[model samples]
Target chain A: MIKWVDVYKAFGEKKVLDGFTLDVHEGEAVVIIGYSGAGKSVAIKHVVGLLEPDRGTVEVDDNDVPTLPRKELYELRAHIGYVFQFAALFDSMTIGDNVAMGLRKRGEMSESDIAHRVAEALELVDLPDVQHQYPAELSGGMRKRVGIARAVALRPKYILYDEPTTGLDPVTSAVIDELMIRMREKLGVTSVVITHDMRSAYRVGSRIAMLYDGRVRQVGTVEEIQHTKDPIVRQFIEGRATLEGDAASLAAPGPAFESGATARGGGAE
Target chain B: MNVIEATGRWVRFRVEEAGRAGRFLEEAALAFGSVRSWLPNATLQMRRLGVDSLPIGLLIAVFTGIVLALLASYSFTGAVPLYFVGTLVEKTITLELAPVLTGLALAGRVGANIAAELGTMRVTEQVDALETLAYDPDSYLVVPRVVAGTIMFPLIVGVAMIVGLGAGWLASIGLLHLSSDEFLKGARMFFSTFDVEYGLVKAGSFGFAVTLIGCYKGLRARGGAEGVGNAATQAVVYSAVMILVLDAFWAMTWLHGRS
Candidate 1:
């Protein structure tokens, strides 16, 4: 289980996360959807021990992630897999070498075992033939697949995906979504996917959380989220938040009353 | 007044940068509590920073040796007694060529590669990924490069010195018709172990300067493609300039020590 308790993050003067809390139950696949700076990325970072909260605790399996000792923390992280937005493939190494990197760090795996596991991970991602190719030689989609292979190669119990489908075509997006679903079903992995694509969220999310203004606006099952009567949730899900008087009010700047008047004016009749 | 303030600001900045570097290493130690893993990371990074760099470093080493020989022979022709031959040759390579050429060669090779890799990782958010994974990016990234530069630099300079000596010997004996024994004897008298040590120390320091600057610039890189290009260029240019300034300071200090 992963839990965020009243997390607060600020960079200089800008508050990126403010007293946010969300719990992802064991075996749950939660997809976080939000605007770019809405702090969805920051929120997941807390889950995996990336960024600690200023005044809150991030617990992974009831153990405080941020406060864990270095040795304990690295051990805890060994069970988690993170895929970067750009795939974050080591450009200098061959595909097999990149896949073997994390395992090699653990310092117990034999060369043959590393090779066998890398091959298996790549096979799971449908990229078995790309083991020898460098990242520069592969297409973007292929590179992301290799990234996924590397992440899964570690056999992590928890997998965190940061914008896995961004910049990918719809077909590629669907492929990744299926892979995400398949991993949870096959490996029983607890997954957290942070993305802005509502379609992806709907496809992979058992529980969908929408982050707004550095807080989780709502977290629920896909059916509950889609059919909810909440205006903010509806506006966001439909990609028509621009029509909200709230959005207009926020986007426009002035004294509160004048901005309210403009927001009201801008709203659809 | 502004100029004085600016100069003061520059000095203060260097001091702060040094302090930050110290703190960064301390945090890195905390992050990498396992000395076992840390050593391997350093070794893997060292191999990449050194062995991978050998081919390119050797190319510069060879050419730099040949150039020193050629230039000195040309300029010193008929102007000085032949007994001065080894003194000039030894001083040129030991004091200047070994260290300068090593830095120059790496500015084009290791420095550029470090900037490019770090810059790309920065842009792609890989370093951020490492941090998110609870790994200190500086430890995983910069420490290895620093170690490689510090260790491999001396080795690289040694190669440059040997090649330079051989090339100078050939140019003097084979090309310039100088007596082989006199040229060889001049070298034996003027070449001291201390000179080589001085050159090696200079190489190590220069290596640290270039790698840190390259890694720092790269780790902080933003914007996009143009940003990375700018970073690579700045790393090379600044490292080269710092190498000269540091070389001059070392020279004055060494000269003082001898006197």
Candidate 2:
């Protein structure tokens, strides 16, 4: 389980996450939906200790992520797979080598065993027989799949997807959404997908959390979020411009939604 | 901003940059503790940095040698002995020209390439991906390039020295009508092993400076394509400037002190 408790983070003077809190239990997909700069990616990054919260705690399986020692942090990271938005494939390396990098670093597997596992992971992603190809040679969707293959090659306990379907076509986005669902069910791994695509959230998420201002505005099942009564949530769900009074309230923001907004929000449960 | 405020900001920026450089050095030192893991990458980088650079180094050395010999001959018309042209060419090429010129040339070639490659990776988040995969970026990305540079720089300089001398000798004998024996004697007259050692030291130091600055600029690159381009340009410019500064330091400290 991952828990972000009263997290506060900022860059220079801009507070990106203020008293932001969320929890993801084991073996479930929780997709965090927010605007482009809403800090959804920042929230998931804390779970893997990629970014430390300035004033709160991020715990994974009860291990304090930010304060963990370097060795322990690496050990923690070994169990968490992070898929970058751009695939982040090493251009110089072949697809096979990219997939095999994590296993190779562990230094316990034989060359043939690593090769076999690379093949298996690629096959799981339905990207068989493209190992020798470089990332530049692959299509954008294929590269994203290769990125997923690389992440799952380690058989991590948790997979963090950062806008996995952002730039892909709708059909390709559906493919990625399906892959996320399949990976969760097939591997029984927890997933935290950070995306603004509501369709993707509905398709792959076991529960959807909407991050607004700085905190989670609402979190519940897809239907529950869709039927939410909160004006902010309703406006966001319908992709409508905020109504006059709603805009005024949201625009006057100095961390407008206070801490514990999640608790008071009816849709949170 | 007021002049004082502007000056304060500049000072702060320099201090922060120095701190970052110090941190980079610390990380690079730690990377050496895991040197065994980076050997394969080091070997590949050595081939790329050293072997591929040889032809270019040789080309520069040969042309500079030929030009030196021709210019020295023009000044040899008076009481100055024609044989002295050989000594002048040999000393300048071996002690200064070969190593410094080769380093400057590579600062543009290899340094820019390293920065551009790593900068692109940074912008694309490949380096972050390495961190996420539990791989140390310093060991995987930096150590190999630095180690390769330190090892290859001296070898490239040695090649440059030999080729430069050979080209000078040929130019002296063929173009200037100087006898082989006279030219050879003049070349060997004032030669000292210390000069070779000085060149090697300079070469190694310049190599490290070029690669480290390149990697530093590349890793720190932000924004996007424009930032990557700027990093590559800065790598070349900084490496060239550092190479010249190191050259002057070596000349003042080592050569002058010894003489």
Candidate 3:
């Protein structure tokens, strides 16, 4: 299980996450949805020890992520896979090498074993027989699949996807969504996907969590989130702008809203 | 801002930058504790940073040798023997020109390339990807380049020294109207093994500085294309400036008591 408890993180004056909290139990997919710059990515980054929360705890299997020693952190990370938004493929390396990176780092597998696993992972992502190609030669969708292949090459127990389908065409996005679902079902891996695409959230998420104004606004199944009565939730899902009076009221001075107000005021002046 | 406030900000920026550089160096040193994973990359970088640089380095050394010989001939007009021009060329190339000039040239070539490559990776999140993959970015990305630079520079400088002396001898014999025997005698007159060793030491130190500064600038790059461009430019400029500074310091300290 992965749990973020009252996570507070700020970059300069911009409080990206304030008392944000969420939990993902074993063997389930929980997609966190939020608008751009809403800290969805930041929240997932904490799970992988990529970013540390300033004032709260991030725990994976009850191991404190931020305070873990280097060796222990690396050991923990070996069991988790992170897929980046841009694929983040090592351009200089061949696709095969890119997929094999994590496996090679473990230093326990033979060369032929690593090669066999790379082929298997690529086949799982439906990207068979492009091992010799470089990332620059692959299409965006293919690169994203290669990124996924790289992540799953180690057969990690958990996978974190950061905006996995953000820039791809709708058809390609659907393909990626299907791959995410398939990976979870087949591997029994706990999955956390961070994305703003509502369609993708509904497609891949067993449960959807909405992040807003620095904290989780709601957590529910896809059907529950679609019919949620909360105006903020409704406004986001419907992609509708807040009415002027409602916007002003929502922006009113309050402790829960202080960071947003300060950030906007500072940006304006 | 007021003048005092501006000065304070500048000081703070410099101090912060120094602290960052210190920390980066520490991490790079720690990376050496795990050299097995980085060895293959280090060899590949040696080809890129050292082997590919050979022709340009040699060309520069040859021309510098001819120029130094020509200038020395002008100084040896009447009283001094024309052959001493050979000694001057030999000593100057071995002690100063070959290593220092080669380092400056590579600061522009290798340093800029390292910075640009790493800066692009930073912007594209490749370094973050490595970290996420449970790989140490310092060991995987940085140590290889630094190790290549430190190891290859002296070898490059050795080639530069030999080619430079040979070109200087040819130039002296042809342009200065001196015999081969006279030039060879002058070249061998005051040859000390120490001068060559000191030059290689300088070469190695300069290589480390160039690569470390390049990696530092690249890794710290933020924003986007503009930041990458800035990092590349700063890598070359800073590496060159540091090479000159190290040159002066080496002269004062390493060569002071011995000379």
Candidate 4:
């Protein structure tokens, strides 16, 4: 399980996360939906110790992520897979090498075994016969699939996806949605995904959480989020412009999502 | 008050940058413990940064040699003997020009290459991906480039010196109408082993500083393409400045009493 407790992070007078809290249980997919710059990515980065919180603790399993020693943190990271928003493939390396990089770092597998695993991961993502190709040679969607393949090849217990379908076409988005579902079904891997794509959220998420004013405003099953009465959640999920009296409120920027917002049983999961 | 505020901000920024660089250096030094992780990568970096840079180094050396020979002949027309052309060319090339010029040239090429490549990787999140894979990016990315630069700078400078001397010898014979024996005699007259040692030390220091600054700027690059471009520019500029500084440092430290 991954737990972020009352995390408060700020950068030069701009607070990105304010009392932000969430938890991911095993064997389920939790999708975080929010506006741009709402600290969705920042919240997820805390899980991998990429960003340390100013006044909170991020726990992976029972281990405190922020306080873990360097060797321990690296050991903890080995069990988690993180898929970047941009695929983040190594431009200089071949697709096969990118997929095999993590396994090679562990230095426990034989060369043939690593090759076999790389090929298997690529096959799982439906990318075959492209191992020799560089990332720059691949299409954006294909590069994303390779990114997924790279993460899945590690067989990590948890996978974190950062805007997995942000830039892809609708058909490509559906393909990725299916891949996320397949990973859950086949490997039973726990996942935490950040996306603004409502269709993707409804499809892949077992539970959905909406972030507002740097904190989760509502979190529930898909049905609860879809039928939410909260005007902020409704405006966001329906892709509306602004809430009632929101234009003036946005100018002054007071506390947001405070009224008519339901935290649904007062729990993140 | 406004001027004071701006000056304070600039000073704070430089202090923060110095702190970051110090931390990065400490981490890089720690990464040297993992020899297996960086050795192969260092070998690849050496070939890419050093061997492949030979043509440009030689090209700069050739032109510099010809210019030095011509200038020496022009200056030594009257009371000064023509053989001093070879002596001047030899001393200048070996003691100063070969290391400083070659360093500045490679600083532009090697420093910019390291910065641009690593900056692209940073902006694209490849470095983050490396971390996710449980790899220390300092060991994998920084150590190899720095190792390559430190080991190869002196070697490239040595080769450039030889090529430069040969070019000067040819120019003295062809353009200055001086005998080969006179040129060789003048060249050997004022030569000292310390000159060559000082030049190589400067070259090695240049190599280390250039690549270190490149890696420092590159890894810290944020945003997108513009950030990468800025990092590359800073890498080259800082490297050139650092080379000149190190040159003066070595000259004072090594040549203070002897001269």
Candidate 5:
């Protein structure tokens, strides 16, 4: 389980995360939906120790992420896979090398074992024949799949996706969404998906949490969020442009619970 | 009051930036402990940063040798013997010109390359991906470039030294009216093994500084295209300046005591 407790982070004067909190239990997919600058990516980054919180603790399986030593932190990270917003594939490397990079670095697995795993991962992502190609040769959607293959090759216990469907067309976005679902079903890995795509959220998430003003505006099942009574959550889910008066009110905090180990907020807190 | 406040803030920013760079160096030093992680990459980097840089180094050395020979003969018209031109070329090429000129040239090429590559990776989040995969960015990305620069520079300088001297010797014979024996005699007259050693030392230090500064500037790049551009520019500018600084430092520390 990954737990972010009252996490507060800022870059200079811009407070990207303030009192942000979420809990991702094992064997389930939790999607964090938020506005463009609502700190969705920042919150997920804390999971892999990419960005440290200014105030608060991020714990994974009872280990405090911030306080862990270098060896321990890296050990903790090996069990977690993070798919980047832009795929972030190493352009210099071929697809096979990119997929095999993490396993090769661990130095425990033999070359044949690593190759087998890499081949299996690419096959899982429906990219079986592109191992010899570089990332520059692939399309945006293909590169994203390779990124997923790279992560999945590690066989991590948890996978974090950052805006996995942000830039793709509807068809490509749906393809990535299916890949996410397949990873969950096939690998049984816990997932924390950060995205504002409502369709993706509904499709992939067992629980969807709305982040606004660096806090969870509402957390509920897909059915509940689909028919939420909260004006802010409703406006976001419906993709409605807010009027001035509604915008002012929407900026205010909601009554959702700040954070909890179980479902927190909108009566769950 | 506002001017004073702004000035103070600027100074504080520089101090803090320096502190951060120092800390980055410390981390890079620690990253060297992971030999297996960086060794293969270092060999590849050696080829890219050193062997590939040879043509340019030779090109610059050839022109510089011709110019030094011409200038030496011009200045030695009557007062000094023609052979002193050989002595002057040998000393200047060995002690000052070879390492300093080649380092500055490579600071523009290799330094900018390192900075631009790493900066692109930074903006693209490849470095973050490496970290999430439990690979140390410092070990996987930084140490190879730093190690390549530190080791290959002296070797490149050694070749450049020989090529430059050979060019000068040819110029002394072809352009001036001196024979091979006279030029060779003058060349060997005042030569000490320390001259070559001093040049190699400076070249090695130059290599280390150029790549280190490049890696440092590259990894800290922010934003997008503009950030990468700024990092490449800063890498070139800072490493060029560092080359000159290290040149003077080595000259003062080693040559001043010897003289």
Candidate 6:
């Protein structure tokens, strides 16, 4: 249903993706796993036509996404829902309005019909009675639920999740994982989840693709990935492993170390 | 902390925002310059700011016409020759009241609106959403405002000129016992093509500055309610300040060119 063929993308002098290609079958749940800045987000952004590949084509339902007219592109996008990281709910709106935004923009549905669908979407995300509340008033976990509800409000055939559980507590993350499983079971919709949370990826992904340095290192079932003894993969899975050689090299980059170590140069509160 | 020191901090933050506003304008102008891809957004922006602003702009013109006449009658009562009242009415309405009042009207109606819309867009990620949707948000959001300002400023100025002239005629005929024909002749006596051209130039420049500053503040709006409030305040402040400065500049150049 989706394909990225020989894609190349760059920002100024830095090449992010070079000749990257991938395919996702119909109704398949594909999870993209990678470390930060590994181009996981960029890859999904291509699938949705949010970012166009410079050299190659992205196809949704066999139609070249970048070449589609504005109306056609919007129509195609209507079938694919997106849940952004940080929820990105409209802070100016109530939860109900946020979910209703997609439907209202279509301008074909009646007010009553939109209201009913919004309620249904919220219910699907296990959120009830929170429609009247603003996004700023909700907990982070609850806001993610609103984001999920809004993404699914259009009854899209596909949904994309970008780092869904990154900022959540462990328990909340587990809850979100369960919800993802139930959504696939209940809706039978195709899902593309970009995540670093291994447990969540395992729970939700029918097939997992591990992206490293802007290319797919491996794509297989959860067992295939988990059991693979590839040293680089295993080391990353072991959580931030550093070989003696890596430590020596990282240590030897003196200016780099000193720059990173400056506490005063770090993020402000 | 002492009260004075706390107030000083507040003042510093305000000063910082003024600096931020200047930076936002520069960035927005640069971003809007990249309209090679997205042209429709500029039109949509026109619909929102310029076309939408017409009704209230007209209302303001009409009211100002009547008020200008009423105020002028008081000042001219027995202080000047009665026959000169008709010409004075025409000159004041044509030369000053029409263009200036129309601008003031827009400052309230269109100015407040662009600020709020842009401010809301700033906080809601709608601006970023536009970028994600592959449309250049600034060009879409701003260029329309500029176009609308250009189109509507002159239109409102025209409306104000006509109504103000008519109101002045009524006042002169009713109060000063001058005939309509006499008043119109004297009003037309001072009406040079140069004066008309100069007023249009002022209107065009004023309108552009108002819309540009208004939209820029909105798109760059931050924080929550406080941020929006600041954008609104700044929109009005910057627009008003720019208007006075530009008016002075135009007046100097116009007089110099004519003389």
Model 6 misplacement above 4 A: A241-269, B1-124, B128-259
Off by over 4 Å in 5: A243-269
Q: What is the TM-score of chain B alone in each candidate?
A: 0.84, 0.98, 0.98, 0.98, 0.98, 0.80
Comparing candidate 3 with candidate 5, which one achieves the higher DockQ?
5
Worst 10 residues of 6 chain A by lDDT: A260-269
Chain B TM-score for candidate 5: 0.98
The better candidate by lDDT, 1 or 5, is 5
Q: Compared with the true structure, what per-residue lDDT tens digits does model 5 show for residues A168-187?
A: 99998998999999889887
How does chain A of candidate 6 score by TM-score against the true chain A? 0.88
Model 5 Cα displacement at B154 (Å)? 1.0
Return the TM-score for candidate 6, rounded to 2 decimals. Answer: 0.64
Off by over 4 Å in 2: A244-269
lDDT of 4 by residue, B1-259 (tens): 9999999999999999899999999999999899998998999999999999888889988999989999998887767998988899889999999999999999999999999999999999999999999999999999999999998999999999989988999998998888999999889999888778888888999999999999999999988999999999999999999998888898787778886
For all predicted structures, in order, the TM-scores are: 0.83, 0.93, 0.94, 0.94, 0.94, 0.64
Tens digits of lDDT, candidate 5, B1-259: 9999999999999999999999999999999998988998999999999999999889888888889999998997789998888899899999999999999999999999999999999999999999999989999899999999999999988888899999999998998978999999889999999999999999999999999999999999999999999999999999999999999999888999684
For every model in order, the TM-score on chain A comes to: 0.89, 0.89, 0.89, 0.90, 0.89, 0.88
Model 2 residue B250 lDDT score = 89
Q: How high is the lDDT of residue A55 in model 1?
A: 83
Highest DockQ scorer: 5
Error of model 4, residue B199, in angstroms: 0.8
What are the per-residue Cα lDDT tens digits for candidate 3 across B167-247?
A: 998998888778999988888898899889989999999999999999999988888899999999999999999999999
Question: For residues A70-154, what per-residue lDDT tens digits would candidate 3 score against the true structure?
Answer: 7799899999999999999999999999999999889889999999999999998889989999999999999999999999998
Q: Whole-model lDDT for model 6 versus the true structure? A: 0.74
Give residue A129's lDDT in candidate 6 (0 to 100). 92
Model-by-model DockQ, in order: 0.38, 0.67, 0.81, 0.81, 0.83, 0.13
Question: Candidate 3 chain B: minimum summed lDDT over ten consecutive residues — where?
Answer: B76-85
Candidate 1 lDDT over residue span A1-269, tens digit each: 88888899987698988778889887889998876777877888777676778888899988899899766887888788998788988787899998888888777799999999999999988888988889999988888888888888888889999899999999999999999999899889999999889999999999998776677777899999999776556767876534354443444445544643443234221
Lowest summed lDDT window (length 10), candidate 6 chain B? B128-137
Estimate the lDDT of model 5.
0.90
